[model samples]
Target: MPLNNIPADRSYTDEHEWIMISPGQTSVPTSPVRVGITSVAAAALGELVFLDLPEVGSEIEAGRTCGEVESTKTVSDLYPPVSGEVTSLNQAAIDDPSLVTQDPYGSGWLFEVQPTQLGTLLTAQEYAEKNGA
Candidate 1:
């Protein structure tokens, strides 16, 4: 899918990050959100070789470095689109870096999060527009 075609139901950030906001408010002030690398980011990285994800329960801040991926060309850092504690990582991607190259938006997702700040993200459409996608 084109990055500019952001789902209206979701939000995005300037850094080309997308957030899938969960329905309903919980103990946390806002809905929990899932984060993943943008299609643009994955494409630029080329074929991935290694992914270094944080352990679950680790606190992450918006715009802060959280992880890294080593591609055929170079290593790139993973940035958190929102502040939160990591809830999960894609085990498949950890096992096979190629998954990130093939399906970045799906099974290649790097992490799920319980966002501490929901306002830090942008919708898919917004990010796409800014990136000229």
Candidate 2:
């Protein structure tokens, strides 16, 4: 199956989450990072139907189960790419989960976090190679 194009600007988790350190932000700890699932993940999930995202101001740890994603195919845990306090959530995606698969990078973003630290992340090339995308 063909996967969606992977953007080169962000870091990705093996579990298929993508994290973009906000523009003009030089460091992970200084600014909020946008979090979302990679297009490959969205495709694999198969027509997302539901989402459970962390609340604003809630502390989230990288690589931990912060929320959940439910698709027609199966349900999967949502893992943060960095540890921090959740700054905001994408209410649009929560209201209509298909945005995740329909526009994985833009309006489909899941949340933003003011990160304290980051977890293991792979470069876009590395992620693509690892997943054979």
Worst 10 residues of 2 by lDDT: 21-30
Predicted candidate 2 versus true structure: per-residue lDDT over 1-133, tens digit per residue: 1133878778888999999853233466677879999988898889999999999999999899999999988999999988999999999999999999999989999999999987888877778898888
Task: Work out how many backbone clashes candidate 1 has.
Answer: 6
- For each candidate in the order shown, give its overall lDDT on alpha carbons: 0.72, 0.88
lDDT of 2: 0.88
TM-score, one value per model: 0.81, 0.91
> Which candidate has the highest lDDT of all?
2
> Which numbered prediction scores highest in TM-score against the true structure?
2
Show pairs that collide, candidate 1: 11-122, 11-123, 12-121, 12-122, 12-123, 13-122
Candidate 1 TM-score, C-alpha based: 0.81
Q: Which residue pairs show collisions in model 2?
A: none
